[model samples]
Target: MIFVPLPYVVALLLAILLIQMVRRSDGNKPNLFFAALIAVYALQSLVIGTRWGYDIVALLPVQAILAAIIPALAWLSFEGLRDGRSPRNRPLLLLHALPALMILAFVAFWPMPISLALIVIFLGYGSALTWLAWLGPNALGSSRLDGVGNAYRALQITAFAILGSGFIDVIISLDFAETGGTHSGGIVAIGNVLALLILGTSATVAGTSQPASEDDGSGNEIPSPVPSAEDARIAASLDELMQTRSLHRDVDLNLNRLARKMGLSTRQVSGAVNRVKAMSVSQYVNDFRVKEACRLLANTDDPITRIIFDAGF
Candidate 1:
């Protein structure tokens, strides 16, 4: 009978997910990093599968390398989704790689140290992800994603998957100790394969749900403003701009562009819209687009396709 490794099957699915991310990534750093994380997990599964399924002793060091890097990739990808900032701090990111570097250095001579290091990395990063999830949507405030509410749910699932990975490692370690380092490889492979499936799918869903949109603006925080004449004036000016120029029809309009057109700062625009409309700037903009769409739909004989485009939706 021809041998078929489960990891190979799972890794193949993950590879397909990675390719989808790349095709739809559109230069979003968060998505790209997420894809990289998925790639690492896929390779990790493949390595573990090969080492156990074929009993390849020489591949042990390679497995060690992939395992060591998993936590680092997890943390970095989480940061990417949280911050939604491109061109991240490269120097700091390089620091996360230290664990993997240490593993590569000691894998040949001191395998025990590598094993201990992986344990610490998994536990530490897993706890960190869990804590981040505990913070809820506020933790994802900096993200430019559209469906933050849904994304947060996906984030929680991803966190649990990482946390599960840590627990799996602990269980495997205990099994190794109990069996004199001869625990069942099938169990380890199955656990990791399931984990990669969950993590890869959750991360992909969360990352893709937040595609770049014109309404996302710069995603800079806006200070809340007291309702006052200045706020009303700014809001009125924005209203006039939208009405007179039909700027809402642009479909590419954002806070910065709207602010620039009105000769106001982005902060002022955001503040004014928030205080006057009692809603987010994106919401305020969408309201106008929705109204226009409604008008087009009711009064014109335009198809929905044309109406959506014409109404800036």
Candidate 2:
């Protein structure tokens, strides 16, 4: 069946790729939450594509994954957005787990009422996650955030919306299984739109243009950019600064000075740094240097200021 395309597919794909990139970029430690997200998506595809989807009993794994994945992700996504507070609504999150376990356990023994209950629970999470996902973009305008985080967040939100919508629509499918009348009309329409949202978000979340192994600054090796006039200058200057062996020795490298040395448009330079390196130029330069200084402070006879300078303060 044909599914319309939308922005959500891009988001979905990005959500998958972002964590993997972050993992590779930072260290080999993969995020279980993000990895689980990828599995949930694959299972969703499997359920939708195969004949096993029609058989709820055979779809136990799919349903179980959907139930567990959405709520946990919703909570985690919310935490990331809010910068991880102590989790005030612990009870609410737990309630979500209960319904999932209930569905999983009962499905093994009972099918009818348990299926209806599962459908209802799915609808609830579907509606909630979808709303939260769409809500993030509206609050954080597409133009406001830096490219990497914005793209990652956008994908996160869009995927939740699409998959969430799919869950809700599927619930309605169950509700209208027998009659398939006027009540089903709304569900069908909603399902179609949700399907498109899923497609778009999925593409972005995956970052499929590059293989899983490569990470050459685009975060995905989609071929190095041509290095526009602005980027070329910034890259050259940064390379020069790094090679100087003295500049990196300083710990307090000012953005204004760097801006002056590069002589390119500061805005372009900043954007390039963010998109290419995932950090502001000042941060890119100073943070690691600071860490080095701290290490020197603890381990050597270097004076604080000397260490700071050595670290490129």
Candidate 3:
């Protein structure tokens, strides 16, 4: 009988996933972080496959370290996707180092406390991901533009997938304790494979569909000059800004930028635009571009390509 390890299958799938993530990443911060997260997961699975399937225990410490880093990477990737920024701060990297350091210390000397701490890590990050998932489409920030609902849905699913992974960790930890060192590795291998498949697909979908970043250090919150009840006044100011400045001519314009230009909160801008324009911010912006395009097509002698660029279509 020829024996095939499930971990090998998992590793192979993850390798393919990594390649896709890399090809689709396009240097976007969220996508890059997501790719890194997938790479880490792949490395962890490779270690597990070698350890359990091949009985190689040399990389056990590496596996433990990878496990500690997974949650942090997952959270960071989600944050990058949400906020459209990925900080390269050294302190953040150092903070993530704490988990791996604790695991390494356990591997070297103190082994008893690490188990409980691992559970804490899992449940803690899982709760956070679950909360973000509960935020629904809003959690996607500016990425919640036209034709992007599917990507947002994929991200929500991925958040739940992360939460599921935390519960799986709890189950595995309990199994480890209850079995007195006789836990079935096959079950864990299967669970890891399934979870990785889900995460990889969701990450790819969400990452590739991400809108280009429109933030230019101008999205910082400023006090709303008008009260919430005065949405009409805000709407009027926004219209004046759009008409006078032709801000809609910028292809990368978003609600945040519009709000910043008008000195209003995103919520205020969104509400005003929604109530007054009777359409989404993206739709409202497109209306201006479409009108301009129609004008150019009807009256202009310029080439269609030049007219398209000029009209910001």
Across 97-177, the per-residue lDDT of candidate 3 in tens digits comes to 687788888989987776677767767776877676665443555453542444555656666766676677677777878
For candidate 1, the 10 contiguous residues with the lowest summed lDDT are 211-220
Task: List TM-scores for all candidates, in order.
Answer: 0.71, 0.42, 0.75
Candidate 2 residue runs with Cα over 4 Å from true position = 1-24, 28-31, 53-57, 60-68, 85-96, 126-156, 159-176, 179-199, 202-313
Pairs clashing within candidate 3: none
Model 1: how far residue 35 lies from native, Å:
1.3
Can you write out model 2's per-residue Cα lDDT over 1-313, one digit (the tens) per residue? 8643332343355465555557654454343444555555545544443422243346555555464555555444433333222336444545546765776666667755654565565556556555555543222221212222343454565446545654664666566676754454455345545654664455455443322223312233333444567665676667667667545564334434455566654455555665555554544555456667778988999778787656654
Candidate 3 lowest-lDDT run of ten: 215-224
- Range of the 10 consecutive residues with the lowest summed lDDT in candidate 2: 138-147
Q: Each candidate's root-mean-square deviation in Å?
A: 6.0, 13.3, 6.2
Q: Any runs in candidate 3 off by more than 4 Å, and if so which? A: 1-4, 25-30, 81-93, 142-151, 181-183, 204-229, 243-255, 277-279, 286-313
Q: What is the C-alpha lDDT of each candidate?
A: 0.70, 0.50, 0.67
